[model samples]
Target: MIKTNTKKICIVVSSLGVGGAERSSALLSEMLFDLDFDVHIVSVLDKIDYPYKGKLLNLGKLKAEDDSKMGRFKRLKIFKNYLKAHKFDYVIDNRTRIGLFKELIVSKWIYNAKNTIYCVRSYNTDMYIYPSKFFAKLLYGSAYKIVSVSKAIAEKLNNEFGFKNLEVIHNQVAIDAEELLVKKTIKDNYILFFGRLNDDIKNISLLLEAYSKSKLPHNSVKLKILGNGKDKMMLKQKSDTLGLSNHVEFLEFLVNPYPFVEAAFFTVLTSRFEGFPRALVESLSVGTPVISVDCKSGPNEIIVNEKNGLLVENHNIEALTNAMNRMLEDKNLYLQCKSNAQKSIEKFSKSTIGQQWKTILK
Candidate 1:
């Protein structure tokens, strides 16, 4: 049974599907609900896949039904009405705020600034605060709080925008008890890279290059790249060109990728930048050590070099290749990392992060 509470909170998100930030929002809703707050979710998009605990206001469904300009106005009116009706104690805005005019209207006319919290979930600040830095400051200046998912993001915002109300909260992972208990059997020896297949940000090409150079291919270890994106075909072609057609395997995104992570030799990340890389943390939580390029704002915080996992310098193809080779050849080092993996990420557990949110909400 859910306990009742007077402090009502609403989470506004772009979608609750297929992305790290969206997953975090879904987890936040469940956390707030479990913390006895009357949690409500307002997903702007209609792609709800993750399990969440809250009353939903799916504006995307409404948009899908009526996509006309008039329909947009109607949705806006409905959104304003819903906020007015609920009188929520706090509204956490987790959507990308790139449209300056649209955000200005929403901030000035719709949302109550003093009770609203804005979240910045990417290293690319332009996605969350666009047009101009001065405008972003003016826009979010009076917000109850501006929460950055990593300390690097928070520091960047502070340095660039001089915003005083900033908080750093790392994304939490939902470690399943059943998953932990299940005995994972490795069917094949493959290194894994899961998440969006975007090349611009994820830098998957770098991963492919590093994998091709690594000694794992000679040892008959395959490279499994999972998830879908616009660059899927391109990445596949690159794999073929690298003569890795037989060695590299592409799998579609899975709702629960824990089994894949658990069964892998280890997971690898080669992103250029990240707000907080969930794949690395998720991999570690399942007792799988990871090899990641020490990208901006995330990997340094999560990985201890040669401890829980290997953290190579960003964009260094040779360094990553060497790390991968070491992980495969160094049995003692790999075992040590695997043993430390699950315990290293205990700070990112749901309950620990939930308590942090509870304090922020209060």
Candidate 2:
């Protein structure tokens, strides 16, 4: 009798950065490892921001310390050789495929289409890059499955690229009540907003504008913005100009931000779009209500208006301000929302999502 080898999986990502998509990939890798599968990760970049339970193959060292492009082709050959040696049963790719033509060529030439799973983790991804729509079919048509993190993203991809094998698998959020409810740095009653401080996509300007217009600033309730990004200085300048310098506090990115989320009266997100907003689900998991923009995707799926949290019109400053004021001042409503938060997000628990991936892989 011939013995079959234990299934080996490889998760390909840009990097294990602190972004939502990177964290989700790491979490999935962790889950696969816990299930007794041989798991490996291939990160294009060297940065490892999130924790993972896999053997890492960092390609960041391919370039010299000076970031020279001299060994680009040599690195590609090395990467292909590495994949050939491991012979992964399934390569679940989680990187953004927008403009990665060279990488796409590597994937196309080296990876078996029947054993690959391409993941699209952003809403309307084709719109992000100029030629993505035109190249979508060419890039992902060979993959066995194309997974999207939300129904919105899946539908968008299908409409734009006509991918017949597209699947929607929502990301999971796990919260240890004891860990999240533990002591936080700030002991004050405050509303929270945490993500990369990018104005164009995250539109934190909408958040700051809402906070400035809200009544909570006058009632001793503070607004805490967490996470650092390219627009930090610009956002800080805006806050100063809005006279919110005193009321709004910008906090640096914390690896563990759940404690802050748990301690907040409620968390807020004002993004233009999302594949799946992990922060909102995470906030709910930590027993904190959220107020978020009803963006292109994600939020509408998670937030049942007036149930677990409040959903405001996308980029509507007045509506967001009113929602924030309600979350702060409306004690009874706030309590009701808080009480309903955890239960509403049970579907997004790690075990439930892990089972989905297990089924698909099997």
Candidate 3:
């Protein structure tokens, strides 16, 4: 009689950096470890810098960080071969559909494991979502699970690619309620927007345009941008072209963006799509009201329209403009929103979300 190996869970991701998906994976690993499951992680590139300690770790070092299909195939082969020797109860591909076909090929050929899962973190632009859905089918064919970060994303995945085994679990933050709820210095009159400018996926330009058009006094609603990106220079250039250079202030990344989240009158997020934005939840946890473009999943779920925070239609300049105007012109609304917003994060903290993961894995 053959004996079955004990369950060992491993998460395979591009890296465990300060990304929404990466943070969630790292948090889940911690939770699983606490639950006494043998948990480990595998990174595609060993050298990628991650924000937290003991969150995600690399497996056998590989040099195929290149974007080519063959290069990704080789790296996937190496990782899958390693797993073939040591069986795991569950193995998850935390990669989006960049070169997902290679993931499918290697899983089918090398591991042939009974339980495999694919996780997607974004609903991106309309242009790429269709192609990504097609590849997701090929990659996740007959898998144990196909999961997304938010209900908005899961719905899109189901309707677009027909992913049936989908689950919606929000990201769990290492939030300390006692640490976040004190009254912050009411810095006079500036609203804030924070995110990486690298891919322009955050869509800072539209936010700038809306801020510029609001005709609110600079002192009334100045925009402070945080998180550096590859497109930072162009985003700043576009702000200048639109005469918002004076209205915008860009800051370098910090150990904690919480102080900024506290200092700002409110926080804004203008992404095209998000799995579940950590910034949005963090700002709310800190008692700072948020105004976000209802990109895909996170914002609407967090903001109760006019109750806690406000949501605007995706990519609609006028809708975003109205949201800013409403928040700026209505002083009572700001105070009400801020007071109401702080309580919105009760369900998102690690304690609340960890048990959800326990159920998902079980």
Candidate 4:
């Protein structure tokens, strides 16, 4: 049932599969739908795995049918026509913006800059904003709003690009009651690492090294990694080289990874940098404590040292090893962290974040 006189909104995303930002975009659609807005989603790629609520414009399908130079131009014309036809009150863009000329054409010709909201979802601002200050300003300066997923990212953008129209809206977590009721399937005392297998950003190599050094291995506590990426083979080989092949288990990505998260002794993240780590928040949301490196932009905000989880100094192998050992050896500390997990992250709940979006959209 559609609400009367509802403002229409279009969400543009890179894809609806296999990435934190993509998952965030899908969740945002659901939030907008619940708010009674006429929501639409435009996925640039063909992959669609996450459940979302919106009428979809899958441009990827058209590309799959014909992927040539002229075909690309045809897709652009279709996208432009769709925007014009809908006349959406707001266009929330969640795709990575690179290549200045391409972004210029899309921003100036395709999208109505006054109503388009550009989202910056990574600490690497280069991926979202062009390198040249002048060009970046020309591309996004006129946007209705520039949403940064974390305060640190917002600060970086302001300090570097001097953009005035910036808002900080952290990524949100939806704690499903049904997922909570799902029984744990894995029968092992294991700590978990779940996210992309990419080592360039996730620094999964550090996680493998830290796990190998930790005392948990000696105690027969396994390390399980979930998700897939280009670095999967490299990581598996590294585990084998570290003689942890038998101890560490590699699992495929699941649509509902909550059961694995819930059953874990504790979840772990070792990313080199993050805009705002959904994994840490998701783990804590499930009442499972997390162990993470104090990364540049996010971990510090999420991990309240010795409260919800352990926060180790970034890139320090010894510190991470010690943190892992402490979580397993110190019984009282582990229980205390677990007890405080869910309550500490109430601020990041879907309702709270949704209200912030309401303010922006209104």
| 1-362 per-residue lDDT for model 1 (tens digits) | 66578898989999999888888898889888988999889988899988899899999999999989999889888889999999999999999986888898888888999999999998988888764778987799889999999999999998888899999989998866775565656578899999988999999999999999999999999999889888999999999999999999999987677788888999999988899999999999988999999888789999988889999989999999999999988999999999999899999998898888888888
* TM-score, ranked from best to worst: 4, 1, 2, 3
Residue pairs in candidate 1 whose N, alpha carbon or C atoms collide under 3 angstroms: none
- Candidate 4 Cα misplacement greater than 4 A, ranges: none
Identify the runs in model 1 with alpha carbons over 4 angstroms from their true place. Answer: 179-186
The alpha-carbon deviation from the true structure for residue 55 of candidate 4, after best TM-score superposition, in angstroms, is: 0.4
Which ten residues in a row are the worst by lDDT in model 2? 126-135
Per-residue CA lDDT of candidate 4, range 60-126, in tens?
9999999998998999999999989989999999999878778988999999999999999999989
Backbone clashes in model 4, listed as residue pairs: none
Q: How would you order the candidates by lDDT, starting with the best? A: 4, 1, 2, 3
TM-score of each: 0.97, 0.94, 0.83, 0.98
What is candidate 2's lDDT per residue for 178-214, written digit by digit as tens? Answer: 6555675677889999988888889999988989998
lDDT of 3 by residue, 209-313 (tens): 888888554555678888776888888888889887667888776435677788887788988777788888888887889899987767887888887889888
List of clashing residue pairs for candidate 3: 198-229, 198-230
Maximum-TM-score candidate: 4
Quote the positional error of residue 286 for candidate 1 in Å.
0.5
What TM-score does model 4 achieve against the real structure?
0.98
lDDT against the true structure, per candidate, is 0.90, 0.83, 0.71, 0.92
